[model samples]
Target: MFPIRDHNPSGRTPYITYTLMAVNILIFLSYVGLFSDERALSRFFFDYAAIPARIVTGDGALTLVSSMFLHGGWLHLGGNMLFLYIFGDNVEDEMGHGRFLGFYLASGIAAGMIHILSAPDSIVPVVGASGAIAGVMGAYLLLFPKARIDILLILIIIFRVFPIPAWIMLALWFGMQFIGGVGSDPNAGGVAYWAHAGGFIAGILLTIPLWLRLGGPGFWRRTDGHPPHPEARYSTSRIPKVRR
Candidate 1:
């Protein structure tokens, strides 16, 4: 299950978040056609995607930032964008445009470094905004633990959308990454679990000062772990049961 949206919305317009989404989308579109040719696609990723082994050799240092804007496929791009859209706004609103952008890029770089540490010899190319978006998720969890998030659950023909506390969802997601990181070999990666986990941890660490500036635990006591603004309410949707 994944979040469809959140009940808490930011008070200000998240221009930086929207701009980030646009840039990621446009960059993915610009290179998506290369998928038609395996060699061409591989070459493209080699030039732009973060490779742990390349990083160890003191090369492709820039790909850590460039790779945040690249995606493996439509679904990969869509999922990361969805997450950023949901959690990014409030974090951006809290950080403001300039600081949030800096935080995001820093998270991505930290994530890449963690991945390199996990598999310095691996040649696999990592791409996607997930590492950066994971940072936003990290920040969101710290700032709004009690916020309501609607999760879309799919079980074959059964489809459902249900609201749950953000803490439950975010904690569960972080746990999954930890489990995956422990169980999978980083060199033979399908998912960069370490990067996700590292980025999430980094996001939280980076946001701590801001949280303290807003009053730390006292802030939570004041807002009850919700956004310091009115929470949005959404209507639930259900799929009609098919009669046999």
Candidate 2:
């Protein structure tokens, strides 16, 4: 199952989220050609992506930020962007643009640090915005736990769309990350599950002050754990009748 959209709409424009998506897309496009050349791609990833060994050696420190905009393939980019698109706007709305941007960067950096700590001797280069986007998902869970998310479920030929609480979706996602992180080796270099899990926890901790400022548990009671505005309604258009 994948989230298609959320029922809650931000009261203001989320310019930062839009800009982040565009930047990630543009950066991915810049390196799309290198996919056909394995050596060149490896070189590029080694140079820009977060390498745990290099980080442990006190080198390539800038990669923590650079790596957030890089992706291994089209699917990697698409999946991360989809999650960001679905969850980012509301978090950005809650935190305001400047603070939200800072939160995103900090969470990503924390994620990279956690990954480096997890496998300091691994030479594999980790690249993707998933860690940062995971942070967004975490914040969304805390801020809008009751918000309805429309998820598209597909099982072979069976397909369906269902609306469920944001907390349920995010909780399941976090649980999967934790399970994957525990099951896989960090040095294997496939999915950075630890980074995702780390970023998620960081996001919740980072958003706690904001949540408190909004009145903590009382905030939930006030907004019912959703956006403090009217929910958006979606409907399908009926087919037009054909004239004889």
Candidate 3:
């Protein structure tokens, strides 16, 4: 199951979120040509992506931020952008533009550091905005736990959309990350589960102050863990068949 959209809508335009998506897309496009050449791609990732071993040796420190914008492939970019598109607006709406950008970057940096600590000797390059996007998911969970999210569930040939609380989806996602992190080798160079998990925790922690300022548990009581705006309702359109 993957989230297709959320019921909650932000009151204002989410300029920062849109800008972020555009920047990521543009950066990914710049490297699209390198994918066909294995050696060239490897060199590109090595130079820009975050490699734990290189960080451990006190080098490539800037990659912690750079790698967040670098994705492994089109699917990588699409998935991350989708999540950011679905959930990022509300978070940015709550935190305002400048603060949200800072929160995103800080969470990403925290994620990279955690990943480096998890596999300090691993030479494989880690790249993607997943870690940072995981942070946005974390914030969304805390701020709008009861918000309805529409998920597209595919089973064989059956395709259906189901609406569920945000907490359930995010909780399941977080649980899977932990399980995957434990089951896989940190040196294997696959999904950076730890980074995702770390960014999630960091986002929650960073958002705590804002949550408390809004009245902590009282905030939940006021909004009932949903966005402080009218919820959007969706309807399915039916196609009419022509009589032959």
lDDT of 1 by residue, 103-186 (tens): 999999998899899999999999988889889999999999998899999998779999999999999999999999999999
- Report each candidate's C-alpha RMSD, comma-separated, in the order given: 0.9, 3.3, 2.2
Query: Which runs of model 2 end up more than 4 angstroms from their true locations?
Result: 236-244
Task: Note the residue pairs that clash in candidate 3.
Answer: none
Q: Which predicted model would earn the best TM-score?
A: 1
Give candidate 3 regions above 4 Å deviation.
Answer: 236-244
Q: Can you rank all candidates by TM-score, best first?
A: 1, 3, 2
TM-score per prediction, in order, is: 0.98, 0.95, 0.96
lDDT of 2: 0.91
Note the residue pairs that clash in candidate 1: none
If the candidates were sorted by their lDDT against the true structure, best first, what order would they fall in?
Answer: 3, 1, 2
Reference-based lDDT, each prediction: 0.93, 0.91, 0.94
Error of 1 at 61 (Å): 0.5
Query: In candidate 1, where is summed lDDT lowest over 10 consecutive residues?
Result: 228-237
lDDT of 1: 0.93
